[model samples]
Target: MKALKHLNKYFFQYKWYLILGTLFTFISNLFGVVPAQIVRYALDLVKETISLYFLYDGFGAQTVVYEIFAFSILLYGSLILIMALLKGIFLFFVRQTLIVMSRHIEYDLKNEIYHHYQTLPLSFYRKNNTGDLMARISEDVGKVRMYVGPSLMYGLNLISVFILVVGYMLSVNAKLTWYVLLPVPFLSGSIYFVNTIIIRKSEEIQANLSKISTFVQEAFSGIRVLKAFVQEEPSTVAFTKQSNIYREKSLDLVKVDSLFTPLVSILAGLSSVLVVYIGGQEVMAGRLTPGSITEFIMYVYMLTWPMIALGWTTSQIQRAAASQQRINEFLNIKTDIVSTKDISQPIEGAIDINHVRFVYPDSGIEALHDFSMHVKAGESVAILGTTGSGKSTVANLLCRMYDTTEGQIKVDGFELKEWNVQSLRGQIGYVPQDVFLFSDSIKNNVRFGSLDMSDEQVIQATKDADLYNNIMDFPEQFDTVLGERGVTLSGGQKQRLSIARAIAKSPKILILDDCLSAVDTKTEHQILNNLQEIMKGRTSVVISHRVSSAKLADKIIMLDGGHVIEQGTHEELMAKEGAYKELFEKQLQTEETNS
Candidate 1:
């Protein structure tokens, strides 16, 4: 209930829908009472007319009176039919107002969650799996819709129909009405006793479902790896084990859920028996007329659907409450990476990393230790390090993906955090180690960073990245649609396309973090040569392990285990007896050996 309280705003938003739906509910129930009243009146009329004919010994009045009675019955039967038809029409309008409003709320909730997902930091995604996130937005929200739509409609129907029909029953004969409603307290108690267990079971089912979804998502996403390792049989066994757990959880819930309908039906059956026995006694005692007894029976039957439906409505509400709690858990997580400053500032590309120390929040890994670097506007610096030496962390910092744990970083003499986050990221073009491409046309992929890029600009960016020739060989060229994650291209081609995407943005600062690892030295050298012209008058940081990629930089820094081991120009580093010189000689030997 605490979690479901989150939906109160939506209820207020669609207040008119609820109000109108309530109005229709009352009107429909009123029509139900009218038909029952008409039946009662017709039955009493027949009884009275037949009795009078018998008292007079059918003195030729019998034939004429019988004919009139039949005519009156037919006319009353038509009125009952008209009332039923009107009730159905009002019921349709009830669905239109309430159910349709639920859909609008669903649309709004989905958009709200998706927009929040976009604003969440990368760290948030790290702590949560994609499958769980997807489930909350899709499955969880769907359950909430059940509560707002069908559950709400049926609940109102139960309330309005019960009130109107029971009130009429009291008017006809209060004693019989009390006997018929004897089941109400027991029903209420049964629902109360079952509520706690239902909620607990629903929560377990939803959680187990999330785990199953995550397992399937991972299996499908990594199917290629499973086949490559020849572990398909093992994967299948693991999946079967997980599915068995889900099945058990579901069956436990179904065991409890299966009780609701039968329980409600049993109570309703008891009500019918009471109407037959007690109402007959009342009629014999002259407390209730035969017509009144018939009306009481008819009203009890009228209440049956709303009574039987009450259990289903209660179950859906419990499930929805459970699911809504899951959704709110994620929605309440506050992101720590939002911008503190609201002002935008121009970046001249001068950067200073003054004794910065940083650790990854999710894994608690110290990626950078006392790292310090200085780059003037238009200068190019290459960070040379082995894997896990924090070369890529520097790129992440410059892009403001994560702030430093200990020290301050500044761009153009302003603290990184002081500048608007969007403004800061927009000015930096970063090509990370893991290249990702959407399943879109080649031209659109290249134009991803800057959507307004002309075709000529897109072609030139690809050319600079040394991928224009490869794209031109394709049937559709720029318009060629890529498969999932750009599977249509080779590894090197994908890397080049990612590079093209970055450079197309024309940022004030450019950072390439080992993006050329897939390409051969020849292609790497060709692309770097083209980048030399592009890097002019803009701050550039090239992070790589290859000496060939660093030789042309204005400055070079070598790192080891999150610490800077050496720093100098390529010429100066080669002049010294240090790790940088040793690495350069070894790389040069490898090239020579390959040649």
Candidate 2:
């Protein structure tokens, strides 16, 4: 309930709907009770009319009695119909207002979560998986909707109907009402005992279901890998084992869940028995009418459903509370990154990394230590390193994916932290090593860098990336839709498409983190030459292991174990016979061997 308080603002936003819905509940219940009263009145009138007919002793008043009785029955029957109609209309309004409000809240809540997700730093994604995040936003929110919609609506109906129906019963005969209620304590005790078990089992079932869902989602996504390894039989066995666990937990819940109906039916039967047996004595003693017994029985049956719904509604509310707590946990988390001011000006791509040091917070592994670099506007610099050399970390910092643990990075003479996050990212085009393309048309994938890019610019960008001929060969050309992560394309094609996407925007600064590794030397040379033209006045940083990628840069910096070991032009580095020359020769020999 404390966690559920987060929804107070939404409830207040839709306060009028709640107020009106609640009002309708009572109004509907009020009309609902009137029908039972009408039944009692008609029954009494019938008995009195019959008694008067016998007392008249065939005085020819039989026709008058029959006509009067018939007319009264017709009038009372019409009134009962009117009562039922009014009750149903109010129930309709109750759903219209309450249920609609819940749906609106659902929409608002999902958007809020997704918007927050966008603001969080990359570290958050590293710490959590897609399935968990999706479940919080989708499944948890649906549970909350159930609480706000059906649980709330039915709860109000139960309170309204129970009070009105019980109050009227008491007014008719207090003693008989007490007798009919004898089964309530027994039912209450049984519910209290079973409810604890139901709550525990429900939680287990939900957890197991989430686990199974994640397993199934991952299996489908990696079906190709599974088949390649020939592990389908083992995978099926594992899945079956998980499914059996889920089934066992579900059956346990069903055992407790299935108890409510018979328990309610039996209790309601007891109440009816009390009504008929106890109330009949009152009628015989001339203290009550047979109509009174029938009314009490009708009220008992009327309360049956709400009584049966008790455990279900309680469990629903509890689950909703738990789910809302999960939602609140994410919402309350402050994003590590925040957008700074000064977004009005454009960057000129001058960059300075001053003795920067960074360590991954999750693993506490240092990625960079005392790294420094300087690049003037329009100059291309290449950072050369092998795996674990922290070359990619330099790109990540430039994109502001994570802040440096020591020193500071400046862009256009201003610190990276001082610039607006969005404005800063917009100026830099980054092509990551891991190329990810959406399941969308090739045109849209290229246009992702800038949605408003002209088609001509997209075509030119693809040409520059050396992928124009291949795209044109496809059946749909620009409209060709790729599979998940662009699996339809070859590895080199995917990498080049990612390059095209980055260059499509014509950003002031370009950061390519080994994005050209998948292509051959010939294609790499062609794209690098094309980039030389596109980056004529734009700053560029290429991080790669290949010397071919770094030889053309205005300056090359080679890194080893997170520290800069050498920095110079290609001619100067070769003259020195240092580490850079050694690496360049090694890669050159490998390329020659492959050719």
Candidate 3:
């Protein structure tokens, strides 16, 4: 009942269409009832008498009999015609209404789920699969649409028809009505039991299907790796296992459904047979007329469809209920990160982290411990660390993608929480380790970073990122379409393009997270030099393992195990004989050996 309440908003919006459709269905069923009544009347009018009313008795009943039969035929024909017309009109409108309603529901549900995903942190996606999430948004939502459209209307129609038929049957023969209803409780109870099993099996099947989809999605995405490693057989085995599980669950669902309808039909049939036995005896004993018995049988037959429809509706509702629960679970998740409703005044790039402690929510492993740092406006600082040393965490905290567990972060002397998260992020340009590009023209990808920028501005950013020559080399130049995720470009080209995107933002602060790893040292140096001039008076945080990259910064911060170990200029660090000096000397020896 609680789950059904969710549908009220949509139902009320289209209530008028549903009301008209119901009215037409009722009228159609009423006309459908006429044939049985007409049969009973015609039997009473002519089953006896006959012989052309004993060869024209004048006013002795021949005229009366013929007229009664003629009127019955004419009345039933007209009702049938009207019913057919109404059915067609109602059906068309009902279909259109359901389609329109389902479309809106699908759109809104998908958008809500998608927006939730955006607010969720990177860790959430890292722990879940691409295929599983895709199935929930696509397949699960599709089931809800099916429920809203056809199942809802058909279920309602079934109830209305059942009520009309049952009432008419009781009026015809009260004894026969009791006989028919004897089996209803049993049949309905059995259907309810089967429905429970169906819901459980359907959920299992959907879960397995998600796993199978994930396997296929991952296999195709990493096809190159599988080929390189020559692990096709192993991959095939894993895929087959997932497929088999999905198949097994699906078959379990089918087995239950197969038994459900047959059992329901048998119970309904038993009731019909019992009704005929009792009503036949009544007619033989003259307690009820033959014409009345005929009408009762017709009503019994009419009852069968509604019975079957009831069972089907039960199954559909059960499946939809399960789907709704899963969808609701996703929609209810609360994001740990949310900006204040009201933003403070904008900043001019001074950032201070005061005694911050932070951890990934799910893992509870601290990524930063009592970390404190400060950067005045226009200061360029380099962060150096080995893997798992919190270099990226520092950048993420500054952007407020994840909130600190303990301590205050301030921008331009204002608390980070006081500023709108989006506005603060807008001021910081970021180039991540993995570069992502949409399947669009190169010009469009660059323009994405600054939608309202002029063409000259775009060209200048591309030149500064050292990607202008690469874009011009293609036949279509800046207008060339990149394949999915910019697959058409080499590693270095993709990295340079990402840098171009960041540069186009004209940010007050730039954070590059090993974004230049793919570019050669000479090109890296040239781009860094160009960036230094452009980034003047704009705070920057450059993260890298390369000493050459660190050389470009005004000061360097070295970290080890989520804690800062040293902070100084390159010359000062080399003179200090610490971790920085050791790493730089090792790199120098490697370069000399290569030379």
Candidate 4:
């Protein structure tokens, strides 16, 4: 019930529909209970011994019993027919209004969760899996809808029937009504006791289902790796174990449901037996007539449905409570990266990192410690470092993927936090080491950064990245559809495609973080030559391990252990006979030996 509080706003938004649905429910139940009273009157009229005093005096003197019976049949028969028709009509409206409202709410909730997912920080994604989140959005949302629609409607219907039927029975005979209702309190207590267990088991079942979803997702995504390592058997075995766990949890929930329904049925049966016995004794004592006993029995039969419905409705409510709690947990997560202040002006690409330090949330060691650099506007600086030397960390910081833990980062003289995140990111073009492309055409992939990019612009970006010739060789060229994650392309083609995407953005600052590691040296040199022209009058940061990639920059910085070890022009560094010169000589000797 506490978990359902999140939906209060939506309920209020569409309160009119809910109110109408409740009204229809009440009217439908009102008409539904009228047939029992009609049956009572018909029984009294057809009795073998009729009291003339109870009938109209003129009709009693003028008409025979056969004439009275025929008259009663025509009048009561028409009334019952009309009541049934009205009940059916109101029931239709009740279903239409409340059920459709639930679907509308489901649509809104799905969109809200998806929008929230987009705004969450990258760290949040790192902590949660795709399949688990999908379960929250799809399965959990559906369970919540059950409570809003059928559970609520049926619960209200049960209450209406209880009140109307009980009032009618009490009017006829209060003492017999009390005796027949003896089992109700015990039945309600039983349902309450069973509901606690059902709620706990339902939560466990949903969690295990999520685990199975995650297992299937991960298995399919990494199927190629499993086959390559010849570990398919082990993966299958693991999947079977997870499936078994899901089955066991589901069976446990079924067991609780099995117990609840039968318990409710048995209690209802006891009430019916009590009604027959007590009412019979009253009829024999001359306190109640036969027709009155018959009417009381019919009312008890009507009450049976509400009791059974109580069990089913309670089960739905408990299950929905468990699911709503899961969904609310996700919706309540506060986004860590949100703009607190507005920046009106666009950014210029002069980046300054002033003694910044950053540590990943899950790792205790710092990835970047006391690292500082400055690149003026229109300056092209190359970074050279071994693996784990904070080269990529610098690019991440400039892109604002993660904020600095210690110091300040500024673009165009504005602090990273001072500028709007989207505006700041729009000016920078970053090509990461691991490129990711959608399953779309080459042209669409290149133009993804700017939806309004022209075909000519896309072609130009591909040519600049040295990918135009490769794309032209395909049958459909730019219209060719790619496989998942661009798996149809070779490694070098994928890297160049990534470059083309960044180039198509035409950003003010371009950061290439070891994006050319797969291409041959000849192709790499040609691409760099082209980038020299494109990078003119634009700030650029190139991170690479190869000297050939860094030699074209106006300046080069070498890093080790998250600290700058050297910064100079290529000729100046070579003349100084330092680490850069040593690496250059080593690479030259290797090339000579291979030749």
**Superposing all C-alpha atoms, what RMSD in Å does each candidate have to the true structure?**
1.7, 2.2, 2.7, 3.1
Give lDDT: candidate 1, residue 408.
89
lDDT of 4 by residue, 1-595 (tens): 8998888888888898899998999899999988888988888876742565346456655367657667878899999999999999999999998998888888888999999888777667878998899899999999989999999889889988898989988898999999888888898788888899989988998898788888888878777788999998998899899889888888887787777667767877787787778989988999887788778878877877777778788888999999999998888997766555757475567888898988877566587778777889988889998999889988888887777889998888888888788887887888999889999999999999899999999999999999999999999999989998888899999999999999888899999999999998778988999999889888999999888888668889888878888888999999989889998888778767865
By TM-score, is 2 or 4 better?
Answer: 2
Q: Which candidate leads in TM-score?
A: 1
Task: Provide the overall lDDT of each model, using Cα atoms, as 2-decimal numbers.
Answer: 0.89, 0.89, 0.80, 0.86
lDDT of 4 at 54: 41
Q: Candidate 1, which segments miss by more than 4 Å at Cα? A: 55-60
Question: Under the 3 Å rule for N, CA and C atoms, how many clashes does model 4 have?
Answer: 0
Candidate closer to the true structure by lDDT (higher is better), 1 or 3:
1
TM-score attained by model 2: 0.94
lDDT of 1 by residue, 168-285 (tens): 8878888888989999899899888888898998888888778878988888877778889998898889889988987988788777777877887888889889998998998889
Q: Over all chains combined, what TM-score does candidate 3 have? A: 0.92
Q: What's the candidate order when arranged by decreasing TM-score?
A: 1, 2, 4, 3
Clashing residue pairs, backbone N/CA/C < 3 A, model 3: none
Candidate 4: residue 55 lDDT (0-100): 65
Model 2 Cα shift for residue 119 (angstroms): 2.1
Model 4 pairs whose backbones collide: none
Q: RMSD in angstroms, candidate 1?
A: 1.7
